[model samples]
Target: MWPASMPGSILHTAEVPAFDPRTGQLSLASHDLISAPLSLADVFPPEYTLLFDPSPSRPYGTSTSAADADQPAGQSRRKRRRLARPDETASPLDWIRHREKEATRSSTDKESDEHHAAIEAELGTAVEAVRAGWMGKGEDAWMGESKGRYEWREKEDEDVKEELDLVGLGERFAPALDEPPEPLLLSESRSTVSAAALFHRIVRNDGSSCISLDIEVDASEATPTSKATVILPPSSGFLLSQLATWPASAPSIASLGGEKGGWDVLIVDPPWPNASATRSSSYDTFDPYDLWKLDLPTMLGDSPTLVAFWLTNRVKFRRLLKDKLFPAWRIQQSAEWYWIKIASETGEPVWPLDAKHRRCYEGVLLGYYVPLGTKVDLPTLPQNKVFLSTPIGHSRKPFILDLLRPYLLPRDRPPNVLELFARMTLQGSFRRSATDEDGEGDQQKPGIFLAVGNEAIKFNIVDGSAAAGSVRGWLRRQEDTERVCAAEEAV
Candidate 1:
């Protein structure tokens, strides 16, 4: 059914409106922000063990709601529990009782309904406007190809098994080059000596549209893990491939944050321990307090950095970011936003606004960060905003870099960004990766922008070729290794 309200134009803005009748804050379409040119394995079951080296964990301290505890020796980091909903799976009599119980709490129900109804009205109208703009007026509309839900639009897929052993790619590294290489750093190593050599084989290109990149992440072996080609979604797709080789001269751990004069923007999405996970074998979450180990303040660039923290609906997590996390980093929490998951066909939130088990929206907390002594002026932050996107892959969020671009400092070039605890990625990271990394002075004009993550690239270990056959994953990085090596030998 068509929405009751006619679609209106959506204004993607940088500054928060003093007061606008239509959706108090800026609302955007997630789809338009992340229109990747190719299809990709939307979700890669997180294997936290293989990510880049993390700072040494700090001594556990006593804090309320954030106890210092460790996962049992032989257990997984994620916790799982069952949610019993009599309304969804209960017997006819039980269902009646559940409904009756709800009716008995009239005041409570009325207040909740009224609150959510307002959210629905405002958010729904904004989403329809943006979605319609992207879907277009007629024949060029994206939805024309699909009468039902788009196969690519759904958030998660059960059949795409993500088992991988990246080490296998060592065999595919480009044959030892005959000439001396450029300066290289050892800190970028993946797993072991073999993995480091494999990383050396990675090839990067900052010239393409940054809409996408084709890297051969071969997962070959006799066991369950085999070789498979992957298609990473836009921005991230292009950025991660370049990040694979960007750190040839990266600074040390102590220098990571300020070395580049701190990141102009930092997007942190901590995988807080929760009962809801696509699969138990996916990401490894930690106690909320452990996030302190990251020491984010150290990661900031010298200027004001915009921080976007993705939060679950849980109030405790919200409190953690606003009260504890923000204060710790001297970040001034400014506004709250929402990322609503909608159905591709209807542009309606996939779930009811007030669903008890889970709301159709996730909360996003935005803030401006400047260290205690840093004197950079902060920009006015946006308020009460929401971006709507159809879900894809496991917890894969829409690429938000472009949406956040307006707030980036300098306004001349893109912000130097950091994606802390990033998984599949904070979308659109790669769009600017192709730019010269010689810092703010580089005269290179901005082309397109994209994204990357700590564990941004994943290989399923199945046998096959990818769409971009011209690209070779086996390309080698020409680096001047500081350490001596035995003469190259056959694998």
Candidate 2:
């Protein structure tokens, strides 16, 4: 339903008021600010482990012998314990019970009758019997039952209390009678706009409507522990095989040639379509977007906002964005940032290095053009640069949330930001990951997480050999040796 008080001309902005039917109050819902939880595992899961050499500065002594390496020199390192596969027949608690019983049987109590009485009274039923494993079997069994029953009762009561507390919190935070109306899910449902509206808005040159071509797509289902390929929506009956035969609805890949839009802010990362003969060679030589062909006109679709597009330093790709892509998108160039890519192998100062390894940073293209009639808060560009030194995989885009801070809403409260085809995790931003990495798998350690940011920048030497220059490097090498020991143990 169209908002009762909305002006038909501007439906996208929050400046337009929406009325609540329940309370009869006017309110605003801005789509700009999004709330996304900061987590990697939500989008991507680890499928397999990849090993890379640690930086030379930090070195761990590698050993040939397992026994010597496991207990290296002065440091007493606990061997990485490999967990056994669970038993299907019995519950885990049963195994705990078995261990406890065995421990009780073997344990010795060296105490007077007064101490023994205190221990028995304090330990309670099962624990007391377990402690008195030196005692008779009947006594142990009787005490175990008593302790077990008490524990169960206590746990049940705690659960009941927690449930009641949650109910109370729910009541306290309930919406007031005069609250504004919740937003309808326009993206998923109640969408009035269609491809036809977009097509009419762009194709204004000649009135002869072209035939639309149909393309079939098949979405693949991901396994519990695997990455999945996405299938685009299947083609309708509209069929045109060759690019030349493409109808008005579907422009040819060639004609997808840039026709820029008039936008206040623009963010684009054109996939400089580059072909490759082999898959392995593609990462270093081929354009990252070689496979994903995008239509510039279709992508812009009359968006009037600040525009920024990610680009590489590749001569052809750089030239395409500067000369063709930017012009086609109708974005006025404003600023550029060099993302100095550094590998750990290049050593300390994270900068461009060619002697050890060819390293380069990404070039972020920022551009904007004043809208003829649009009112927007022009963002102030940052003079100071930010350096994110972590080694990311190829084509792993920088966090827009981190980079586009200058172009944010000037509000005390958190601003709403939306990400399209985003993969890396962000805090408090609405996200739609085309290929998400949830930071799952063996990397998600129980007590420690993979540290990044300031903490990562500040080096700390863990208790280890001085001969081994860096502790982190040592730990990583130890991880491999531990893996071998685990394999042998399994055998």
Candidate 3:
């Protein structure tokens, strides 16, 4: 079983400043320069010296009153007032400082309120759009099933939970396991395959028990495998060999037919560690620095690459994305969009817009990877757009294919897509499948490749062939389904 939180075994100890959920604020030992509001003195310095408390006990500085007794010990308690110049009065200096503080506070408050209001309005509009016959017919049915399963899991008795101990299970049961020499291919026409097949394939072919597969459509001679999904185990040697042929600056795209070029669109949802995730024990989290270790820049194509990063609302996480992660990947930040979660029943935010603990929305940070000296024409991505939807489960993001389809490069042919740290398969069907039908059931040609850790293989694999037709059609059907469900939910 996947660890409830990022496995304790992984290196998750990255020190981020603690935050207070009650106040929706960070608890910093010292003020963060990035988050601090700009002031007139910040832009144009005064000639006179000003002495104020360094501690942020108050907005301007530490209070001079008896409130110092309530503050923690060792903190600076020496109260100092702003010094006046020989030409200026003390009252004038005090007024200037007070005005600057008030201006900063006003700017911060206005930005915060506007952000909250935008979330509310966008969420409400999306809900109304679904209600106005925009949802697909089968969309709500599938959603209902998923919602039911989620509810059941939540209501299930904790004592009755089945625990699978994987620590030593593999070594104990399968001592002679070896890495598979070739990839495992499963077909619907062939006998049904299961996790047992994965094990057998690994042992028979001398492949690693912890191998992850890349799914592709088999265009060879017609058989049970014709147009069927072929799962290829990731080969480090194969990848390195292919990378050797490409220019050092360009991304190496993996082809189904073993051709050149790299993934055109990359979607990454890093498992950023957080306090809520730790408390819930629902999924694992990773240290922010570990994200830099991912060789994402090596996976891009020669063309301009569009990369979308799912980000948390935390200030530290956003800072890491803008400051470190984007720069390390050689991708420039282009746009930041909000994914606002609405109520399935009321169309309002699932949480209040001003909720202190959990905000109603998350962020999608979009960036582009432009190879040096390469000028590629790319579509402009709108900044600060809001995508409203009722989320399915914890950490599960709404499908954004329809939202981002227009902005993809090489509009003629299908774009090659890859998802990193993927929890579920990215089938073109726009619906999460319950079983591994492969890609046979999809109406659209499959172009997405998924890579995840071995522990995550328990979930369904990608069915490249299953994703058929245009994304617009799937989105229309989804809206129709949501519309019907919303009506029922309101009733």
Candidate 4:
């Protein structure tokens, strides 16, 4: 009889089969057919592999033996041994010996549980005190009390100045601390010329003016990648490479001037702090002085024209710009440009709000001042054009070139233009560096620092001359010629 421990216990006593090629069959015992023997061991790993490894499979029969059935409660059964080879057999007594330890372990667990029960009964009373202490609260835990007058409070943030107590009441009267120092303005000189004229100068100076001059081809004749680094000249007819060039173009103004340079009109956009917005969300850094700290004071010193400062609608920024930034730069108010940014999506008057007589418009304060020697004509100061006013796009300003054109173009012109806090380039505008000192080609393009087409952008370089050769001289002569011509006509 086959042992029940083996799954699908077989009782085969058949003879071996031989293949018959002619009939395409096999002779097993006596008959032949097409079927071939497919052993169970061929379909699955042998039972011996499962036994030695003690693998509990779902489909296969249990590995237990008769010793397992007779084992005591809680006793684990020993797996029935598998034959190593078909010819090998196992003794029944071997199975009983393997399950012996499991039977002993079952009996020991039963005795241990009985002993644990007696110990629990003896210790039960002590456990109650432990539970009570954990659950109890102190007498003062929730005691109610009236609110005290001595309680601390947050101080009101009022403008009233407090009288501080002095160490020696009579002798040590403290003078109020000096008002906080103002924002430092950029006093370093930057030369400002017409944005268009500056663009031409760059073109002529770069020698790449030929490409722009080549009228035969369309504007997009050259692939953007190919012509991105065309060289040009400074607006001053100075042999310096155009600010729009590749590797050679990415240097500082200090490096550009070698030692000395100055600006006529200092246009600036200070990154003043906005309390309502987070640093990341706001296009500006939280630190208002960051713009001043960038050495602007040294950059805007006593230029011929004014410093146009863009201020947000904030009390703090206005104070810094008026009292601190402009003063430090030696620039005074010449005029103002109001940029009313309307929302493109919802063009319902973005700037002007009748509520506070507030327009959706922001202000660009134009401050003007001349250095010790240079002369400027206030009357002739071109009406400060409304350079840029458009609906707001995250951080976009209106294209201000049209507004700037009048002030920039003179009867007798001047050289080069300088743009501060610019995103893109005007054909002639020499935009301030917005990238790493060594970064090439206006990293943010089409927005600022764009190259100009071939045009004769005339400019007069101021060389400390009071007469015709300088910007002031040309202005004086133009006014004189106009007056003389007008007088002759009147006569």
Candidate 5:
């Protein structure tokens, strides 16, 4: 069983002075400079290392006045004003936020009573969990809220925001006509370039251009028995073809039901068709059920392998998983968990808990696929449990591996980890996370952390502004830590 007692803070974060967004750019003082290269754990301390007094996520009230009346006032009205609040002086950005909020709130209010009770109970659980963890929404990052708001929200997202589905690319192997698609294969693996001497270093001075260089970051460590394998993008037709043949590539996929050489844990973050751009903005929304084409059962390791599915707040999507998707995959329904996105400065939900536009919290449905084995080796996850983290970017998610580590198969067995629609790298950068800083828990052995998606390497590059020939890209910012990194789209 998982631990019963809860700690005060689940993850450790670096506290830095807040940068005032009223002014145009990210200045040096406000930024927490990384003296060295970062590893996956350094960017987002999985657990042991790493806010808010918000309403009970299930829609408090729609009074705009009541919303801002309690929020702290500041000098820069535009930057400090809470999101979803509308006013005469508000700009285009404000109105966009307002409309989205209103739509969400209205819909949630009209939910059928049959489902309302369960939604209400789960949401209330998230609110309490966040409030307990926030511990007064620590005051240090208050000024930096402005920078955090647009941290990795680069101007380039407008250009190719729509995703070209790799899963359903059924063509006659026709390559790009204009200029032969020269797939760039960049590898940041355990062998070359340890985290200490990184090719992708980060710096946050005034002059940084947001460029997505095709970099394959392989975040793996060398244990005696098993060696970790990272599958990254080739950035062209090759990538699509490569992913299409994933099932055939592994002989283990031969038997979807019988436990041969299959994965121990499987995570799915499908691009559900929805109106909002929150995460779906970048991906070309398509029939989510298309995922069955991959033949999931062929990938299960042993009996009762863990499977976690991320879903939006939409009831239809939730029902699809509980009803259609799970049954087809033969996965037994289990626990549901929620992740609450809180403001770094205010220690409140980035958006209202049950805002009309978007809810600050999303859910994860956990289940076990019982195959040939009689029992699951992993411990049980709590039902309707909630965890909190500062919002990073439109798509980035915190490393849940840390929370689930203890419950996973022991290091020697080295469970195969697989993630679908992983817009960002699971292990993050292939750089060295400082050993001294990550000395808390026992480290994971050389296990496969395969992150599969069209934009799998989309958020894997190091992001930062350029100086006279310093490292070009560096991850912008992490969920709670002062350090930053490139991450991506999901619930």
Candidate 6:
């Protein structure tokens, strides 16, 4: 049974300071802005005893230890046959067999060629626009001529090391399930939804007991327990609910501001399908066309709304965003940015600028929604900019509030923000991760509404280590200003 001290209501409400309209800048008061590169383990520590490394160092098509053994017999046998082939060469029979299969598959797949050509045409136009704008920016530009070759072993080694560290942590902190876990109280006056209320249990899956949220559990009957308590920083505020619940919840969230109507910023990171993602069995992927059906435009406020989309590099997906999705949403493409994955050790790209198989960067498409006949002066958005960072965990992108601050609406107070398909929870009062080593204290605060699927709630808690060394420069400048103010007061 849970303690009576825990709130009975699933939702808690707290008054947060409104964004200062004069600045048009995002408040990072709740976020630890220390600019240090963090390891994958630092951002998302091993919560369960079983740690599974999805990306292994095995040769292409070869099965790793983590590969599912229960695959169909035919598939397993096929993979085994491929593995049994000689390293440097294939038998003439094997070559002939592969050629026959390819020929048969190609002959039957005529529609694929037409689809590829259509996507290629759309991609070529977008790339040409980018090249035209960045042509004179010189070699220092992100789109500068690439050498077209890379050595990816270092990055792979780093991934392996991080994976091992997670495994070690899991082994060290394996939870005991013989007895009921103790209930943990996470108290914060500003948190509208407590972490205790959001997560029901840490269950083991495939050997590891990572932090998992049982959203299916009835909130009224839930008696959740956590291994640790998390007190959130002041600037954090989150609403924990399934993505389907947002339409019902948005009106209430908007009503909090009386006349705000809807959100000023909408950020979405949909789990778009890809061949690599399909193979890994990570999160469930959705069809790109299904995105067009979402009633996203209805959530936009009367004022100009900023919409940022995290996009995969597939040409077909890009076309869907530009042609189908944007048109349906009535959003005009303003600019595009790249999230470049760099090495934590050397600060260089994990893969070279032009890796043939995989590029080291992902795309972010930014757009704005404007109602008809609404004329407003907006800041010119920079094009083709690169945001550099070492990625942590699967598909966990960098937090770009600092980079996005400049372009946010300059209303009287900070623009209200909203995130769809959100993984990371940003709310008033940021919570420290159990694995955080810096002993960073919490601050009370507020943020925008977040809507995600049930599976995404596990990543909603704050990760203090994500910014580690990355924010030090910015933090130092802030401290220097404070020191000068203190010295002046003393005089």
Best lDDT among the predictions, by candidate number? 5
lDDT of 5 by residue, 280-386 (tens): 44455657666657666666644456788888777766777888777877777466777766654444666664454457777788887766545655565545555
lDDT of 3 by residue, 166-285 (tens): 112222323232322233433222233322233212211112111333322222242112121212221211211111122321232333212313456777777778777898875667
As a TM-score, model 5 comes out at: 0.54
Model 4 error, position 72 (Å): 76
The C-alpha local distance difference test score for the whole of candidate 5 amounts to 0.44
lDDT of each: 0.42, 0.28, 0.41, 0.30, 0.44, 0.43
Could you tell me which 10 consecutive residues in candidate 3 have the lowest summed lDDT? 31-40
Candidate 6, residues 88-199, lDDT tens digits: the string is 3556766676666556754324343453343343333333343344344433233111121101122333322211111122233333342223223333232243333443
Model 6 misplaced stretches (Cα beyond 4 Å): 1-235, 253-262, 427-457, 460-491
lDDT, candidate 1, 1-491, per-residue tens? 11111111122222222354445664432322122111121111111111111111121111123223454522321111122236344458656665676668656445644645666665655555566555534332322222111122112322333334333343244335532143223222121222233233212222212112223343345323233333332222212212223233122211343433446666667666667763564565657876555555544535577889888766667777888878887887466777766554444566655455457777778888876776766665655566755454445555456567666666444355555544442222222332323332343322221233324444211122233222212111112111111233321
Weakest ten-residue segment in model 6 by summed lDDT: 1-10
Error of 6 at 242 (Å): 3.5
Q: What TM-score should be assigned to candidate 2?
A: 0.33
Better of 1 and 5 by lDDT: 5
User: Which stretches in model 4 have alpha-carbon errors above 4 Å?
Assistant: 1-264, 275-286, 294-303, 343-348, 355-359, 379-388, 408-415, 429-491
Task: Give, for candidate 1, the lowest lDDT window spanning 10 residues.
Answer: 47-56
lDDT of 1 at 349: 60
Candidate 4 — what's its lDDT? 0.30
Clashes of each: 28, 36, 29, 43, 31, 35
Off by over 4 Å in 2: 1-267, 270-303, 343-357, 369-372, 375-377, 383-386, 409-491
